[model samples]
Target: MKKPVISGNTISIPSNQEFLADVDLFIEGVLRGYEIDESVIADIAISVSELVNNAICHGNKSEFEQSVKVCLKWINRKVEIYVSDHGNGFKFESIDSPIADENLMKEVGRGLFIVKSLMDSVDFKITPEGTTVVITKAIQ
Candidate 1:
């Protein structure tokens, strides 16, 4: 788990922030291959990076033994990405709104908000094994 591993459209990396750039590069490259607009690629990349960061930091708790997995797919003129981490899941509903007046000045806690704002849809799948975040954005 010292380095990122790539298998087709999926990339798995140890729970470390250093590999965030690697994930971003892989994702942006794939999006570009489909000739997606630059703005759309940036939006998707930002969302993916935010999710991956959460997977490494929050989901995996920065434990090197844990790993983060990201999978990308294109379907129906849309791009869907799934990010998973090996850790107990949390209650998504409990997250306070980032735009709330009390949370507006906080330096953290904005990742999910940003992801949801940029992507067409965001869903969470929680299981005893771990949590997975699925995000989709239309390419057209």
Candidate 2:
């Protein structure tokens, strides 16, 4: 597994699932530095992990040569995270409802649902280069 490279509020890693722990540690450490509440940190961390996993498994197709980048920023009291992947984008609206009875048993397609449920807002920007998911959470 390739190691994650961290620079300031951004971390880039090869598209592999093993570096997920590195991402979680980096994000939690940044949140703690801002003196964020533990519960809120956990929520943000979980949401981020979901997005990162999707970016790796779905977006980049776990290609070792491709890289996933996570960037964090603070605007006023709100924290914004951007997860970008170098893969062809997918239709955002086309995803089926995970809560539906038919989809309830499926293990996939719930990452974005969980992310939206936990974060204040989530947005996706899909371009030829890649797809970038931005999630925001307000700090109390």
Candidate 3:
């Protein structure tokens, strides 16, 4: 079996939210090279931004010394992205329901929901060491 090669398409960004644009640029560049459609690219961009924010705030606890790593992979008509962080992970169940009547207007609790809605699949591997969120989008 040919295992998925883990290329060095990785970026270590500061724990600042401002660097989200850098992440977007890197991701878009790679996807564009793959010849993916613009609408699909935008959806992936939104998902990446959400995950990066989570890594910086919830995963790394917003410590400037801490950094978030976003790893990218392209294989078998699918684009895979992993957003990893240094701090402990959060409970996925605790994320509020964005579409619920009470929480519909809140700015928070929408990222994860948006990610699920946009991507074909979303998975999380979390531990005390850190959290790695794997997101996949179909290119075919």
Candidate 4:
């Protein structure tokens, strides 16, 4: 598996679950540097992990040649994180509600739901090149 590459506020990794920890570490470290609350940092960390996992498993289909990129930026009192995958984009509307009775018992469909609940805002930018998920959280 290829190792993660970090440059400034961005980190790029091959489409592999093994690199998830590296992403988490880099994110938490940056959040800590900004003096964000531990609880809020945890929330952001969880959201980032969820997005990265989706980017690797679903977006990039776990193709080692593909890469998932994560970029972090602080704007005003909010932190914005962008997770992009080099694959065909997916439809956000197609995701089922994780809390519905039929899906409640399932474990695999909650990543996006959990991310929405934790973050202040979540937006998707889909194009022929790939999909980039942008999640923002207020730090104050």
Candidate 5:
């Protein structure tokens, strides 16, 4: 499907794991609009996919009734993404070290870790409403 792009911003369904593709399409389209290089786009897309997957399965608990939301924007040569979910919120520190030698073999607990590595800045805000994780990476 041809992706839509507008002034470096886009939004789409956050319904389920399947929507990860939609997020990728939207992100890549917008990045291309700014003439961003494909390598940098891949890094941002990976970070976004990790966060969106977490929001769908962990945050929204895969509840069909609940949905995650993703918004992308660019400011001052930095790409910013906001991934929010309609489930119980969690603190940033609650996640364990997935790469620890002892935990290295685990199949999970590594999404946020990958995100932190790819983005220039990563932070979260948890409230009764939901959890919003914001990530940014500089575009050069």
Candidate 6:
């Protein structure tokens, strides 16, 4: 497995799930440095994990050669995180509702839903280069 590389406020890793813990550690450490509450930190962590998983699985299709990049920024007591993957983007609008009766039993597809619920704002940018999901939460 390729080790995660951290540079400043961003971390990049091969398209694999094993390095998720490393990402979590880096993120939590930064949040702690900002003195964010444990509950808020937990919510941000969960949302980040979901986006990373999506980037690894659906975004990069588990291609070991591809890379996923996570960038975090702090602005006016709010944190914004961007998770990007080197893969063809998907149509965000096409995702089925995870809470729908027909999809409730499925074990997947809840990541975006949960992220949206936990984060103050969530947005997606799909370009020819890749797909980036931006999540923001207020620490104040």
Q: Tens digit of lDDT per residue, candidate 1, span 1-140?
A: 78999999999999999999999999998888999999999999999999998898889999997999999999999898999998777877798998999999999998888998999899999898999999999876
Error of 6 at 54 (Å): 0.5
- Residue-wise C-alpha lDDT for candidate 4, range 70-91, written one tens digit per residue: 9999999899999999777777
Q: Of 2 and 5, which scores higher on lDDT?
A: 2
Candidate 6 displacement at residue 126 in angstroms: 1.5
TM-score of 5: 0.89
In model 4, pairs of residues that clash are none
- The window of 10 residues in a row where model 1 has the poorest summed lDDT is 86-95
| Predictions: Cα RMSD each | 0.8, 1.2, 5.7, 1.1, 3.4, 1.3
Clash count, predicted structure 3: 0
**Total backbone collisions, model 5:** 0
lDDT of all predictions, in order shown?
Answer: 0.92, 0.93, 0.86, 0.94, 0.80, 0.92
Candidate that scores best on lDDT? 4
lDDT tens digits by residue: candidate 6, 6-112: 99999999988888999999999988999889999999999999999999999999998889999999999889999999767777679999999999999899998
Judged by whole-model lDDT over C-alpha atoms, candidate 6 comes out at 0.92
Off by over 4 Å in 3: 1-7
* Residues 1-60 of candidate 5: C-alpha lDDT, one tens digit per residue: 122223436464545676678678878887888898888999999999898888879888
Query: Lowest summed-lDDT stretch of 10 residues in model 2?
Result: 86-95
Q: Where is model 2 more than 4 Å wrong at Cα?
A: none
Candidate 5, clashing residue pairs?
Answer: none
Name the runs in model 4 displaced over 4 angstroms: none
RMSD in angstroms between candidate 6 and the native structure over all alpha carbons: 1.3
Q: List clashing residue pairs in candidate 1.
A: none
TM-score, per-candidate, Cα-based: 0.97, 0.96, 0.91, 0.97, 0.89, 0.95
Candidate 1's C-alpha runs over 4 A off are: none
